[model samples]
Target: MCPPGTMRNSTGATGIHQCEPCTGGHYCEGYGNTEPTGLCDPGYYCPANRSVSSPQPGDLKCPKGHYCLEGTVEPYPCDTGTYQPNEGRTDCIPCQAGFYCESALEPDPQPCPPYHYCPEATMYPIPCPNGTFTYDNETGLASEGECQPCISGAYCRGGYIMDACAGGYFCLSGSYEYTPAGDPPPANPDQDPCTPNTQCAGPCPAGHYCPVGIEDPIACPNHTIRNTTGASQLSDCRPCPAGSHCLQGDPVEYECPVGYYCEEGMPPEECPLYTYRNTPGAASEGDCYPCRAGYWCNDTGMVTFNQNPCPVGHYCERATPYPEPCTGGRMSTETGRRSNEDCPLCTPGYYCPNDTINVHGIPCRPTYECPEGASLEVVCRPGAYCEGVTGVPPDCPGGYYCPLGSSSYTRCFFPKYCPVEVKCLWNVRLDTWRCHILD
Candidate 1:
């Protein structure tokens, strides 16, 4: 039965009259006909997974959550982040704030708005942003966002902001340690970094200059003394030898030596040590010749004997070596190492070799030689013997082993005195030396 406002096919040859249009939920845009049906309008949803084939005019259908197109019977569903168009669309679109439509003509146009760019490296967007910028790689197409100015004294080269400065440079100013800034930074010549820590100022702290194009303070040059105490500026230069001028951070520039000229820049090479030259006023430390075996620089007697004599007993042995032990009776910093190779040879018998060694022998080790005039207290194997005021041999104790040929038959560390010649006597009960004596 057709509910109100219905049209029936009364003229048909059949006896029963048939209703032409189905009322309720159905609409007919044209004149009433034998067969007519209504459909849901746009924004009005039906059920999901619905299908409509060969849709007629003035008909709209959609899935459960989506309304049909406004003027068509086609059915479409809405996608995530978007809503179905109340028109002839087959899908949904992104909602505001979530995404943007690239353009109005898109089937499912994507959304794009302000506030952020994509990717990394290569700054872009003209004036990209303050503290926020974009880097475009391919012909100004896409860009990536990166942290701004990460380091100092350096920068990210154009697009390569992901890495550090190039080489031989550091990032103190901010940015990659490799990239150079617009204005060149201060140059610290002479390896003097006017940077961190002041404890290691060469020769004199606060009394030098870091020279042009370099960093850190440099030591006063040859022939020049450090006059400007506590270095800050390089204006404390004074006149040196006749031919020299103050160069670098020098207090006084020295003149060229007789054969050599002030070569490198204002002044050149220094006169070799131990030789005299027109170095400072007329000479330098190097200009002094290394005295021969008989001649020393610290003392005098050059005409007939050693001049500039070495301190006391120390000989003029040349070329001091690292780990050099005390030598020739001269004490040195290396003494604690106890490298006997450093000690000077003891005079015949006096300060006997190995006297100060293990168990308090001579200062040197493996010293078989004894002191002059005095015989040793005990004799050891390999021909070493006790040469002393007492004629008796030394006695050893049980559990205590003595070197081959070591003996005196007088005392022992374990017992105050030995029963008899404890050492050098074949032990009666055991195979070793007869050291233990029965009470």
Candidate 2:
């Protein structure tokens, strides 16, 4: 019978030369006869040399960081990108996602480092691409997709985290760098920075504003404007000044038109009724002057005074919308009277009606009395006489009698004798004429 470590192929063996060591991967036991007993078990290895004793001399356990399979001749190191932490292992472990295994003899895989990523079975971590970044302290990034693209308004150069764009400069999404106004486009724009003057990124231009992350410069709205270049935010735009108007994106303000007034951030307004502005750039409502005296401005937006003159029989004060009629017993024959004082009193011996335009009023009758500024005629009294020349009736003379509304006086007729103190009359009761007392 052959020993445990040796085996013989032939059934009939003549000498020790016929006995052979067990195959390197297989084990021999119980005094093997003919063929080897069995293959080596997993996680173990066997050598070709044999002692032919109860315990094999060349059999050994797989070492750490190495593996062995059935019928193995020698221990095999774990493949690159794989690891084995335990001894006597049959197979190596592949590197996990988000981890890296650099050497076949490594005991364990390593976590992916910051700014880098690793895929399953990776031997090394890959750095984030240009214009992209990873968190400063982040680790275990599984794949290239884990790397983040640079945010708008911020930039990320290769191997760098993030940096905010400077004032008056702009950065777009996936930007590697910031751009300023008036700069030329960068060479290799895909890998470098954004181009100048393009919507991608640049400094704000005149009459416009550019906020962070903006693709293009924004125009200042109407009623607001900016003249200087490189405005970084909306606040940089200023409101249009009084007496001027600003259109959208205007670099300069325009003067208000004649007959109009303008205020900050507001459209032009026409001069109000009874007001006028003859020149351009009226700054506000106060800039419009009131209609001048002797003129009437009934309509709005007058550019000049005196367009409508005051008519006869009426007067116009400053800022008057309509002419004022002269008061009763007053007369005016001329145009453009500025005040009631311009109207004159009615003429003597004449009666003037209300709002009379005729300089000379109606004539007084021979029996009526009309004084200056008189609006109506007055009848003459019986004791007085009135002629065209008299504004007030004249008293009758001594020894004279005047009838109602009489223009002249009558003398007393002779009876016995004329009485100087009373009007002379006949005494009907007395046969001879006698002096009678007058009432």
Question: Which candidate number would show the highest TM-score if scored against the true structure?
Answer: 2
Clash count per candidate = 87, 0
The whole-model lDDT of each prediction reads: 0.35, 0.73
Clashing pairs in 2: none
lDDT of 1 by residue, 1-439 (tens): 3333244445553422344433333343443434433454554332222222122322343443343554333344454435544454445554443233333333342322222332222112222232222234322223333323333322443333345334323333334323333323323323543333111112123225333212234555544545543332334433344445444444544455443334333443443433223223323333434434423333221122232433332323442122222343223221222234434444333333222232122431232333322223223442124333222323344334444454332334444334333333445687644443323
Off by over 4 Å in 2: 1-24, 28-35, 46-59, 73-81, 94-99, 118-122, 129-132, 140-152, 157-159, 162-208, 211-222, 225-439
Q: Tens digit of lDDT per residue, candidate 2, span 258-323? A: 889999889889999999999999989999999999988777788888788888878889998788
Worst 10 residues of 2 by lDDT: 50-59
* Runs of candidate 1 exceeding 4 Å displacement: 1-90, 93-268, 273-439
